[model samples]
Target: MANYVFGVDIGGTTVKIGLFTTQGEMVEKWEITTRTDEGGKYILSDIAASVEDKLAEKRIEKSDVAGVGMGVPGPVKADGTVIKCVNLGWGIFNVEEELSKLLALPVKAGNDANMAALGEMWQGGGKGHKDIVMVTLGTGVGGGIILDGKMLAGTNGAGGEIGHICVNDDETEVCGCGNKGCLEQYTSATGIVRMAKIILNTTDKPSKLRQIQYISAKEIFDAAKEGDELAATLVENHGKVLGKALAQIACVVDPEIFVIGGGVSRAGDILIDTTAKYFAQYAFHACRQTKFALATLGNDAGMYGGACSILNQ
Candidate 1:
């Protein structure tokens, strides 16, 4: 009678939890504050307590639960060892084993980005595709690669750290990852704003972007939609770097589709269309036809993906 499963997506601010049937339907979902106090010592215990309370409220016995699958904002090895999670104040440890012991159920864990990709593949934008790559463009860039229905977690669980891929060796500034000219430096929300500032500083062209003291990626895209030449140029520049990076990834993983998510993806077709153009321009001829779409699940992707992981197991 193990008909239900639990999915947990842990973030710096909150932990999203979902109850799902074995058939992949999310029955209920809730969130809890991610208390990072005392080196995050209480996080696991809090989650266990929440699960117990939820089960009791639903009048569902533990024997009716399948398992728990979790997504953490860090690299996770196949054996469920978390390399580290600075935001959670966690060091290298076996997250799956520890949580499993607390909840007294089987547990599976993966990088949050990878879990999002799996979620998209299961029921979101990447549905019906076994090979897909998901790119999330928020404050920073993160990616997940799913090939033939399997997450390619590299030896160090950094297989899909596509943001850190060196895109410009000639650049002098350092990225957040301490790498020079990483893709995230050129494609993320902050990156686009940085590019807009560079364009404003280097060019004499009249632009609406010049009027705004604080620019955002959305503002730039909005200006582009309004036919602002400078904003369009910035978008094109972002497209070039993003497309180039994705093309490189395609040559290796050759995913059937690319699903773009995160806050910046709110630009919708403008972002997808521009990036797809660049991807086609730089892509190997064999990959020129690769599909691209926007992620539909938004924040819930991680929750759905966590449940999918347990169901698949």
Candidate 2:
């Protein structure tokens, strides 16, 4: 009989779980709606049930599994307690201790973005690299930093918050974290849409984008490809902001490579090209030599990271 490991990534709307062999091959995967509005305690019960169901389906005993790892969206204590989860509307809670007791197995926990970075390092784009930075551009910006081959979580495990880095000192749009002018204000999917709307309101340019009922970053990218000056310029502007932000981060971390992921990254080389141009301009000459690559792990990164959490410590 072969032993396996279980990894779970808990998110706002859903929870993804994966079973993997020691060699890193994912043998099974599944997801369940999080129903977070129902409260945090319900989530714990559901997770326990889900693990039991998976074990039964595979005809495996608890002893057959090596360990279980989890990724949470909020700040986690080094000891595995959740400090707070704004998205889930919960305050401080102990996830690791509770889960381990309920499941009768060792459980490791980490911030979701940090786990994603570990996933990339262990099996995805950063496989060969020891020092890496993983950034996710989505509804909001998310990140995880690895330095000198170690997953870096400062004293409270909130250290990898590259998204919260201030990009505009005087600008006012407040972030969910209550700070103003955060990097997410410019680079997230919502930020891109906000930038597009600003152009739409200020310019009288003839654009196919004006016809859309609702605009998204995808529509903006498509319109830019079709030669809409407003859309193209918006992308360029976003690229510049993203590049500048990255350059600043690179100067401090000096990681070997920076992997870009999340939904917005689907724009591919166009986004990469624009961001790279600005990154080159802002980065120190020596830092400009660092590599920027698209993330290869996709959504599965969370699960892989969970499966490999023991390696993180």
Candidate 3:
């Protein structure tokens, strides 16, 4: 086995790569635009070349490398074919076979959120806990589940898609998946911003938020920190929706802990404090034992997750 493993997170906008020691320390990391519009052929070629260049720079031979793992933004078949990638403009990609041929190393591929969960399980907030759930609050929400010390990817590989779980029957805004009332409609970063806009437009109340043309969820979070009642209420609204959805999920899975991660999670206690309160109100009494915490691995969790996926094999 090689002395180091390589991890790659294939996000919608960028590809993050990291070289990691067996002990899970990241030695070096970098990123490149995904540019998936160029076709899967060029994408794989570029990845292969980049790996080759990195190996040469470090004077590491292929024989000294342990393995490679990749986290892609879509479902992957057990045999490594991508079922489809909505963001990458590709379908049925033979990721493992093609990349292994070019790089002369074993490659493991999995759903990006699942890999992130694995990373948290191995090194972040979920460390030392076998059964865990990771919720990433990004442009959208992504969830991953680990049960009985194993990552659960249901048949057809679409499990843990918690964002689409319907929470508000009265909500009308359709999700990208063509569904209305999904949890993301109220819980995602974009959803929070939409709520902020509604508050600004509907109320005559004076507020600092009106000065900005396009407000982001982060701005709302910042405003809440400064004791803005409207911003605080917006966050509370988001928490209630997310909590209702998570309560439903918790009833079924019963994970030991829930780790919240991603950029929006940086809202810290403002988000967590509200979420914990709402989650308790919404969840069944039996599920009250499940602890909630922020993810410790931060942005590198995706790359670490990719590496952990390889370790699993």
Candidate 4:
């Protein structure tokens, strides 16, 4: 039986790869620049070459390795068909079949967000949980849903796109997804900054943020942590918007926990506590007891999740 597994997380800038024991322990992790030129034609071949190099360096034989699992930054069907990945300059194609052919081994592929969720469920903050919702609050919000330890990648692979959930029908501004009032517009890093501008413009309240020409989620959260009243209000609104959205999600998935991650999540306990407080207020009584946590695996989560996915196959 194969005793090793490989996890690959392909992103716009880099491809993170991991060699792991079948049991999920990371043997080593590394990354390679993503050559997205020419429709990303060289991406797969590049990954295959890197993997081969790693195997040779470690003196590991192909027979000792299990199939490879990968995470893509686009919607992917259960059959491994990538609908599209504009970042990678890729279009619809059977990613698994192509990659598998290159390595002469089986391969599995999934949405990058879902892969992070699986990694959390496998060994991160959601380690002990069976059902989980992971939200990544970066420049934009990304979401992943895991049920009974399996990824809930919907038919079109658009599942767990919590950021796009329409939370504010009144929003006149269009979201990056070409929609209005998406949850991401209020809960993501850019969303927070957007709200800050709106709030500052309408209110005469004094805020340190008003003095800073360029404000980021970090500055806002830091000010809130220092007891800045206006910043606090921003956080409160963020919590309310995110919490209410997650409550709606619970009515559908009833996940046991919500794991928060991404750059904005570096705000740590303040972010979790506030979001949880609001979650309890809006969540149904049955799901009000759902737990909350911060994802501990960080960027390595996708690699770990990729390995977890290999086991499923």
The C-alpha local distance difference test score for the whole of candidate 4 amounts to 0.94
Question: What tens digits encode model 3's per-residue C-alpha lDDT throughout 39-115?
Answer: 54467777788889999999999888878888888887656778888788878767889889999998988788888
Pairs that collide in candidate 4 are none
* lDDT, model 3, position 152: 73
Residue-level lDDT of model 2, residues 1-313, one tens digit each, is 3378888999888999998986789998999888677466677678888998989988988777877889899887778888888777667877888888888878888899988988898899888898899999999999998886667777888967988989889977789789998989888999999887877898797788889989998888877878888889889999999899989988888889888899998888888888888998999888998888888999999889888885455
Which portions of model 1 show Cα errors greater than 4 Å? none
lDDT of 1 by residue, 1-313 (tens): 5899998999999999999998888999999999999988889889999999999999998899989989999999988999989999999999999999999988999999999999999989999999999999999999999888878789998878999999999989999888798999989999999888887998899999989989999999999999999899999889989999999999999999999999999999989999999999999999999999999999999998898888776
Off by over 4 Å in 3: none
Score candidate 2 by TM-score against the native. Answer: 0.92
Give the range of the ten consecutive residues with the poorest summed lDDT in model 1.
304-313
Which regions of candidate 2 are displaced past 4 Å?
A: 35-38
Worst 10 residues of 4 by lDDT: 304-313
TM-score per candidate, chains pooled: 0.98, 0.92, 0.92, 0.98
Q: How should the candidates be ordered by lDDT, best one leading?
A: 4, 1, 2, 3
Per-prediction CA RMSD (Å): 1.0, 2.0, 2.0, 0.9
> Clashing residue pairs, candidate 2?
none
Query: Per-residue error at 54 for model 2, in Å?
Result: 2.1
